[model samples]
Target: MKILVTGGAGFIASHIVDAYIQAGHEVTVLDNLVTGKKENINPKAVFYHLDIQDAQVVDIFAKHRFDLVNHHAAQMDVRRSVEDPVYDARNNVLGMLNILQACVKTGVQRFIFASSGGAVYGEQVTFPADERHQTQPYSPYGITKLVGEKYLFFYALTYQLGYTILRYANVYGPRQNPHGEAGVVAIFCRRLLDGQQPIIFGNGEQTRDFVYVKDVVTANVKALDRKDNEILNIGTSTETTINEVYEHLNALIGAGMAQKHGPAKEGEQFRSVIDYGYAKKVLDWQPQYDLQTGLKETVAYFQ
Candidate 1:
């Protein structure tokens, strides 16, 4: 199968490309390298430095006949979205529409999207948020993701386009940028390695469901085989607090690091967790790596 992965040079998409290539599929990566790194692109896969919003993107679709399109490109930072919503919306909402337009025009069969479980559900009082949970996005980033899913649903129902929306939890692992708003794990790991104290917004007790990138890759690969066209939550279904995460990383780094408290950022959620029962039943997928194992691997990579 010929697969096209948008933002293929990114942390999560790079890993997805790895899985696709290992499965003996022909992969083409379409990325502008804006937030994505060139070093992350797999040598085996064909690369095109193109933004998802470019008009020329449609031309590429007319040229290459892609069987699957894994859409991962977006303005992912919640804080940035809050600050410059129009800018963020143009990139994520309009950008996704451009890709979907190409997909429809090119007759692409399957689309696998990287949706955010973190922001889409907002601050769920519940521990495990399922697909059936109420979607009231607190941030523009989350709103755009939800809007993309709605568009995807419409495309599927109207145009017969098959898609799998994977709502991912807080994912961390190798190649993750510590600079991004969502890369708390990577940021904490790097800080701990440097013997710097990590800062936590509000209380250090803010909890999030952490899923490993490798496990995310597994879910992506499995989506290739499944014919389902539903939104699935990809997570461990366990909440880990910010302070606990710090301790875990500190332990891995062989040190104890205290966290500094700061004012909570706008559109920030206090607690988030995703229920994976639907994913397990539908995709026959479950998380394979725990925080300890994944942290050890991620720490080694940073070291």
Candidate 2:
């Protein structure tokens, strides 16, 4: 199968690009190099250094006649979205529409979307929100993701396009950008490796469901063959706190840094976890890495 992986130069999509190549699929990568790094792109895949909203994207689609589009490119920062929603909408919403239009024009069969489990649920009423959970996205970033899912649904109904929406939890592993506001695991690991004290926000009790990147890649691989036009949560049902994450990374890196506290950013979700039971049932997928093991691997990568 010929696949176009948007944001294939980024942390998560780069891993997915490698996996797709390993599975003997022809791959093409489209990335603007905004947040995505060129070094992360797989050499085996054809590379396009352009944004998703570019008019030339249609040319790429028409020329290649791609079988599937694995959409991962977006304005992923929650705080950044809060600061400038129009910018977020332009990138996340309008950019995705551009890709979808190309997909439609070129007769692309399927779209595998990378949605957010944490932000889409907002302040969850349930301990571990499932696919059925009500969506009350707190930030413009989350709203855009939810809107993306809805757009996919519309496309599926109108154009007969198949889609699988994978609502991912906090994905962390090797290739994760430590400088980004989104990836706490990468940030803490980098800070600890540099012998700097990692800051804990809001008493360190805010929890997130951190899934490994490799596990997420597996789900993408499975989505290729799946015919279901459905939405699924891709996360471990367990919630781990920020302090616990820091402790794990600190021990793994042998940094022995003391906990430093900072004021919690407003509108940050205090507790976020998603149930992947439906994913297990449908995709035959379950998270292979526990937090401890995943953190150790992450630490090793940083070292």
Candidate 3:
């Protein structure tokens, strides 16, 4: 199968690109390098240095006649989305529409979307939100993700396009950008490595579900053969506090840095976890890496 992986130069999608290539699939990568780095791109995959909203994307679709579009590109910063929603909408919403249009025009069969479990469910009514959980996205970034899912649904209904929406937990592993507002694991690792104190927002009791990037790639690989139009949560269904994460990383790195707490960012979810039961049942997938092991690998990558 020929696959076009948008944001394939970023942390998560890059791993997926490699996995797709290893599985003997032809792969093409599209990344604007806005947040994605060129080094993260797999050498085996055809590379396109263009934004998703570019009209030339249609040309690529025409040329490649891709079978699957694994979309991971977006304005992913939550704070930035709050600051300038127009920009976020332009990139996340409009950009995706352009890709969808091209998919429709060129007869692409399936779309595997990277949605957010943490943001989409907001402050969750349940401890571990499932696909059936009510979606009341708190931030504009979350809203955009939900919008993307809805758009995929519309395309599936009207155009008979198959899609799998993977609402991911906080994915962390090697190649995760440490400089960003997102990717807390990477940020903590980088700061500790640099002999700087890692700052924890609020009292550091806030928890999140962290899934390894490799596990996410596995879900993408499984999505290719799945014909069912499904929305699945890709997470461990377990919560780990920010302080606990810091302690784990600190132990792995032996940085011995003291925990630093700062004012919690407004609109931040106090606790976020998602159920991956549907994913396991449908895709035969479960997270292979526990927090301690995953963090050790991450620390090794940064070392």
Candidate 4:
């Protein structure tokens, strides 16, 4: 399969690019390098240094004649989205539209979208949200992600374009950027490695479902096998508190740093978890890496 993976130079998509190449798929990567690192790009895949909003994207699509698009690029920072919504919408909404235009114009068959199970659901009323959970996003980042999903629905309905929307939990693992992707595991590991104190915001009781990147890759590979045209939550149906996460990382790093507390960011979700039963049924996807196992690897990477 000839596939175009947007944000293929970023943490998660870069790994996806590697797996796709290893599976012998003709893979092309498109990344602007704003948050994505060039080093993260798979050497075996073709690379393009372009943002998703660029007009030349259509030209690339036309040239590659891609069979599918795995859309992962976005303005993904929640706090930043809160600070500047127009910037967020420009990339997440407008940029997404540009990619969709390219796909529809070139007659690409399937689109595998990377949505947020946590963000889109906002403060989840359900302890562990399922695909059927309500979507009342608390932030601009979440809103834009939801907007993209809605557009995907529209595109699917209007153009008969197939799509798989994978709403991911809080993913953490190797190649994750502490600044942008903002995996708490990565942040803790980096801070500990740098001999700095890792601060836990608020009382540190906030809980999130932390899924591993390798598990996410499996879901993406599975998504390529069919066009189910459904939104599936890719998560563990489990929740871990931020304090617990910090303690685990401290143990993994063997750092004796004291727990540092800070004021919580405004508009932060208190608790978030999502169920993957739907993904299990449709994509046969379930998380394989537990927190401890994933944290060990992440700490090693940072070390």
Candidate 5:
């Protein structure tokens, strides 16, 4: 199968691309290099250094006739979304619309969308949020992701395009940028390795379900062969607090550094954990890495 992965040079998408290539599928990558790094783009993939918002995307789809498209490109920063929502909408919302349009034009069958579990649920009313949980996105980033899901549903219903939207928890591991938002583990590990003080916002009790990149890649691979069009939550279904994550990494790296406390960023969720009952039942996908194991691997990546 020939596949097109938007943002294929990104940390998560790069891993997904490698998985597809390993499965003996022809792969193409379309990335603007905005947040995605050039080195992360697999050399074997047909690489296109262009934005997804461009009309050229449609042309590429027309030419390749991809069997599937894994859309991961987006404005990912929640803070940035709060500051300038239109900018976020342009890239995330409009970019998705462009991809959907291309899918329609090219008669693409499957679209695997990388939706956000961390942001989309906002403040959780239940402990482990599931697919049926109430969605009240607190920021424009989350809103755009939800809107993208809606677009996928529309395309599936009206255009007969099959889609699997995986709502991922806080994804971390090798190739993950320590500089971006949702990069707490990477940032803390980097700082600990460098013997620098790492800052912790809002008492470090803010929690997240930190799933690894490899586990997410596995989910993508399983989704590829799946026959059903569905929404799945990819996560560990366990919440780890910021402080707990810091202490665990510090212990793993043999560091005694104390995290500095600061004000929490606006629109940040206090805690989030996704229930993967549907994913397990439908896709037979389960998270393989716990926080400690994933952290050790991530530390080794930096070393």
Candidate 6:
């Protein structure tokens, strides 16, 4: 199958691009380099340096005539989204429309979306929120993510465009950037490597579900063959506290730096975890790497 992976230069999507190319699929990578690095892109795939919001994307889509689009490009920062909602909307909403419209015009067979499970289901009432949980997002970033899912639903109904929405947990692995729209895992690893203390927001009891990037890539590979228009949560259903994450990384890196406390930023969720049982049933996927193994690999990358 011909696949076009947006944000393919970024951490998670780059790995997906590699896997697709390894599977002997004709792959195209599209990234603006805002948060993506050129070095991360696989040379085997065609690379296009363009934002997803650009009108030029239509031409590229038409030229490639891609069979599927794995949409990962977005304004992913929650704090920035809260500060400038219009900017976030332009990228996450309008940019998405541009891609969706192109898919319809070019007759793309399927679309795989990378949605945020923690962002959409903010401050979960249950321990691990599933696909059926309420979507009461706290930040504009989360709101826009929810909006993207709704747009996919609309496209599926009106245009008969097949879509698979994979609501992701906190994905971390090698090639993850340490700055700009980065997760706590990357930031912590960077700080430890640099011999600096990593700040713990609030009391450091806040939890997140950190899924390995390779595991998430497997789910994407599985989604290609699934024809059902479905939304699946891609997570380990295991919640780990911020403090525990720091401790694990510090142990792995042998960084003797102490943890420093700071005031929590706005638009931060207190607790988030998602159940991927539905994903296992539908896509035959489950996370293979646990936290310790993932952190060890991440530390090696930084070293």
RMSD per model, one decimal: 1.1, 0.6, 0.7, 0.9, 0.9, 0.9
lDDT string, candidate 4, 1-303, tens digits: 999999999989999999999899999999999999999998888999998999999999999999999999998889899989999999999999999999999999999999999899989887788988899999999999999999999999999889999999998889998754357888888998888998888999999999999999999998998886999999899999999999998888889888999999788999999999988987888999998998888888888
lDDT for residue 276 in candidate 5, whole number 0-100: 87
Q: 84-134, model 2: which lDDT tens digit per residue?
A: 999999999999999999999999989999999988988999989999888
Residue 7 error, candidate 1, Å: 0.7
On a 0 to 1 TM-score scale, where does candidate 3 land against the true structure? 0.99
Q: What TM value does model 6 have?
A: 0.98
lDDT of 1 by residue, 1-303 (tens): 999999999999999999999999999999999889999999999999998999999888888889989999888888889999998899889999999999999999899999999989987967799988899999899999999999999999988889999999999999999877679989988888888878888887878899999999999999997546889999999999988888888888986666688887755788898999999998999999988899899999998
Once model 5 is optimally superposed onto the true structure by TM-score, how far is the C-alpha of residue 84 displaced, in angstroms? 1.3
How many Å off is the CA of 185 in candidate 3?
0.5
Q: Over 4 Å off in model 4, which ranges?
A: none
Q: Backbone collision count in every prediction? A: 0, 0, 0, 0, 0, 0
* Root-mean-square deviation of Cα positions for candidate 2 versus the true structure, in angstroms: 0.6
Error of 4 at 119 (Å): 0.3
lDDT by residue (20-127, candidate 3, tens digit) is 999999999999999999999989999999999999999999999999999999999999999999999999999999999999999999999999998899899998
Angstrom error of the Cα, residue 141, model 2: value is: 0.3
Best by lDDT: 3
TM for every model, in the order presented, reads 0.97, 0.99, 0.99, 0.98, 0.98, 0.98
TM-score of 5: 0.98
